[model samples]
Target: MKFEHVILGLLSWRPFSGYELAKHLEVEGRFLKNKVHLSQIYRLLSRMVDSGWVSYQVSVNDGRPDSKIYRLTASGEQVLRDWVTGPYEPSTRFQDPEFMVRFTFGGPLDHDALLRLIRTELECRRAQVARFRTRDRTITDLDPIEGVDTAMVDRVRELSHLHGAASIDAWIDWLQRMLTELGGTVPSTG
Candidate 1:
């Protein structure tokens, strides 16, 4: 989902400045993975205001520069609700760097598509580790330390890949075990 929807959802609760939004996200656990930095939040809010999805009012406090307090417009509310309830549309390609970064950082995302994505990533990583192990064995047999630096680099990469695979495996196992202990699968009703 776009950051705009997240902004709108937060604003739906009440008006807030960019700083306030960042704090809310920290406490509310909505942007755990894509933790919005102060500057990024302000930039997104500025763009949202320009798009008419949100409106802001500049308020000066004490002697500091004016802060823009933002609120979602009626159209923004509608857009947010529609997005929440609308049919899913799989994007051909994701261009957002934050999205990629969040996935890498073990984002606390709990959606069907996210589950599928994690599963796919786990499989890919497992395959990668297998390939690396094979290559490591081959290199070890052929002139063991002929290229010590290159061998060390390969070993490091293999270890990293193995660590990632193990982490994902543990995550999947924990999630499944939790679901089973809960007596069933995750609820379809959001």
Candidate 2:
């Protein structure tokens, strides 16, 4: 997902200046991987305005320079909705920005869509767990060669894989709990 979309999602809730958007992303949205700077925000806002996705008005302050207050346009809202409703590919092996951004703005998504997203993520986490376990086994199964400390090598290698598996397990557990919290059924899948 582009930073443009993130900005649009943030603006979908309310209007904000470039500085304000940057501040919010830096502070409130610090959890997200993609960080937006003030200059980047201003640049994207300009591009969005040109693409008719957003409109802005300059607000003059008593002593400060004029600030451009940006609002998501009707087209922008539609774009955000379309992106949210779009299919999420489950094949990625790493963290997905689409998931992060979509989940962050999930308040606008329908109940069914939200449930589907969580289920899909759960499936992905299950796949990741399997992959990590396989890798861990491969590392542990390596034979010790002459003058090589294979035991230490295996331990070090398994450390990262183990951590990854544990993290995925935690995420899966959280997702399951989320299902119960939402009064949704956990899908019957391995």
For 86-162, candidate 2 gives per-residue lDDT tens digits of 78775465456677777778646556777777788888777767665664266435667788887778778679767
For each candidate, the alpha-carbon lDDT, in order, equals: 0.59, 0.78
Best by TM-score: 2
Candidate 1, residues 1-190: lDDT per residue as tens digits? 6777677766777799988888877786453336668888888888887788899888989977788889989888777756554443333222233333224222232344344443443344444445553453334444545646876777786787687657656754654454455343533211
| Residue 10 in candidate 1, Cα distance off native in Å | 3.0
Clashing pairs in 1: none
- Shift of residue 141 alpha carbon in model 2, Å: 11
The CA lDDT at 45 in model 1 is 80
Error of 2 at 6 (Å): 0.8
